[model samples]
Target: MKAAVVQEDKTVKVAEKAVPKLQPNEILLKTVSVGLNPTDWKHVKNFSRPGDIVGCDFVGKVVEIGSEVPVGEIKEGEVRWGFTRGGVDGERGGFAEYVAVDWDLSSVVPSNVTPQEASSIPIPFLTSVQALYIHLGVPEPPEKVSGEPWILIWSGFTAVGRYAIQLAKLSGFKVATTASEKNWAKLKEYGADVVFDYKDPDVVKKLKEATGDKIEYGFDCISEKGSVQLSQQAFRPEGGRLILLLPTPSESELPRPDVKTSTTLAYMMLGTPIQWGKITLPAQPEDRACFVRWTKITTELFAKGAIKPLDVHVVGDLDKIQEALDMLQSGKHSTKLVLNVS
Candidate 1:
């Protein structure tokens, strides 16, 4: 098997590696396509070792199933898509000819979605699910939310922000988001009720005025670059909860003491502790349970055309992995970049 492996100098190189042995609760997948994300590059620069595999989001066909997997839950030849913590192990990441994934963390691709499109869903979509329903307390879809509450999503054009906007609207909440002027229309199309230019000096004020200080919940897709401060300020004076995709800033760094903050780690959906640098996030079975439940719900949503996959730009195969990573790191692509691996 050939995989994109990290180098000691923080670069990705395609190298030959042995196929992973399947675990009792896992499934062996023949790779179809993989998606590129900012985390992939970050892992290379920050956490990965010389031999770590370097990709996360993937769609693959089940070549083999584990003995412990429930009968009929997943079958050989079924197309499944999910994400793993990339840049950690030599055989575990997505940019490979073969992958072994936990059966519980993977989901069947909807009949209508292509493999490239399905590869773009797992990380961003599930991150939005955790941020809105699990931490922010927004009601999940198919449940009635009493009022037209407003929730702010910072960096609305990002993959996670786009999904958050759509999910919030589906739950009957009015959505407000920050993005550049160029993406305002697309954000609105994704179900954002109001879009503010994040570069504007009065962005927070405009959001407060537009929502009448009723913005109680927020999700910060880009936690750095003053985004957290702006998102916190947009909340009402009484304050509310804010969910972040990165580490939450310390109390003194945050502008408001009233706003409660928590970070969403999508890797936790694997039901395993994540070790990055000196921090070790323990496994939360409850988070995994929520993820498993929503995976089914999201599949139904896709079938009903209620949720749409992000637009994707195919960037060729495994050899193009470094080029795709460079594009993502350049912050130049608005559409998801996918690599055809099969």
Candidate 2:
């Protein structure tokens, strides 16, 4: 097998590696396509150990099932896609010819979805699920709240924000989101009721006034570059919940003292503790349960064409992984970058 392994110099190189042996509850996947995310590059630059594999989102075909896997739960030849905590393990990350994934963490890909499209969904889409239902307390789809409450999604053009907007709308919330002027129309198409330019100095005032100062919940997809402050300020004076995709800023950095803040990590959906440097996040079984339940629902929605994937740009195969990572690091492309690994 060949995998993108981190070097001591903090660069990723495709190197030969042995195939991973599966655990009792895991499945062996022959990698098909994988997605690139900021986490992949950040891990390389900040946290990953030398020789660790360096990717997260993947779509693959099940080649073998573990003995403890329930009968008929997952079968060989089924297309499955999910995310893993990449750059932590030398043998378990997604940017490899073969990957061993827990059966519970991976979902069956809808017949209508291409492997490239499915690859882009796991990390960002699941993050949106956790932020909306688990943290922000937005009612999940098929369970709409009355009165159509407004929820602002900071950075609507981001992969997480795109899914958050759609999911919030499906739950009968009126969605307000911020993006560049170029992305306003597309964000609206994704179910944003109002789109504001994030670059505008008065964006927070505009959003607060547009929602009648009733924006009670927010999902900040980009937690840096003043996004968190802006998102907190957009909330009503009474304040509400705000979900951050990254580590929460210091209390002094947030403008609103009344706003409740919680940080969400999509990797926790694997139902395992994560240790990055001195930071340790405990396992949350409830988060994993939410992922398992909603993944099935979202898969059904994908099959019925009720949900859509972000735009994907397939860069190439395994050999192209480094180039794709560079593109993501440069922040030049809006489309999801995918690599065919089969």
Candidate 3:
């Protein structure tokens, strides 16, 4: 197999490596499409363990299944989309020609979606699912739970933000979100109650005014310094919930007690719980159940179009992995980037 490995020089190089064997609960996916995220490079520069395989979001055909995998849940040659953890990605990653997938993290791609489209779902969709369902207590999809408890999603056009907006809407929560004016119309079409320009000089003030402090929950997909502060403002001063996809303040910058905040690690989709700066936390039985339920629910939601696949900036070959990574880091693409591995 050939995978993109992160070298000590911080360069990504495609190198040949042995194929990985599956554990009793894993499956082998021969990569058909790979989604490149900004994290692909961020993980390389920051969280990297040298020589680590460097990507995670993928869609492929199942070539092998573990003994413990439930019969009929998935089959050889069936197409599936999934994501895996970083840092030690050699045995399992979308950047390679093949990856060992935890069966729980893999889901069948609906017939209506192409492999390239499915490849763009796992990281963003699971990140949104975990943030909304697992942490913030948002109602599950298919049950329309609407009312005064509105939600705020920062960076509405981001891959995760895009899914977060749709999922929140599907769950029946009214939403207020921020993005560029160019994206405002589509965000609204995707179900946001209101869209404000994130670059506005009064962006936070605008969000505060638009939602009337009634924004009781928020998912800060951006989590850059300003993003946290703004997301904090959107939630009611009286109290609310917030989920971040990036590193938050050093306990010192924590928010008001009335307002609860937590960060999500999407790799948890594989049934493991991970804490930043520290690795190797054991999977919690309850969390494993949470992730499994998330997979099943979202699989249905996606197939029915309750959750739409993201628009993608498609890169046509694995040979251009570095080119795709550079494009992601350039921050110009408003869509997810998928590498056609075949």
Count of residue pairs whose backbone atoms collide, per candidate = 0, 0, 0
Q: Each model's C-alpha lDDT?
A: 0.90, 0.90, 0.81
Model 3 lDDT per residue over 1-342, tens place: 988888888778888877878899889989899888777888887877767888988888999999999998878998888787654655555688888877877788889889998888888887888898888876675566667468899998999999999988888888999998999888988889989888788887787787786888889999985788767866777878889997656555765656688788776656665655675656656555766777777678778887888887788688887788888899987888888887
Stretches off by above 4 angstroms in model 2 are none
Candidate achieving higher lDDT, 1 or 3: 1
- 1-342, model 1: which lDDT tens digit per residue? 999999878889899999989999999999999988888999999889999998889999999999999988998999988888889897678889899988888888889999999988989999999888888776677884778888899999999998888999998889999999999999889899999999999999999999999988889999998899889999999999899999998998999989898899888887889897898889989789988887688788987889999999999999998899999999989999999999
C-alpha TM-score for every candidate: 0.98, 0.98, 0.93
RMSD values, in order shown: 1.0, 1.1, 1.9
- Which residue window of length 10 is worst by lDDT in model 1? 136-145
Prediction 2 TM-score vs. true: 0.98
| Residue pairs clashing, model 2 | none
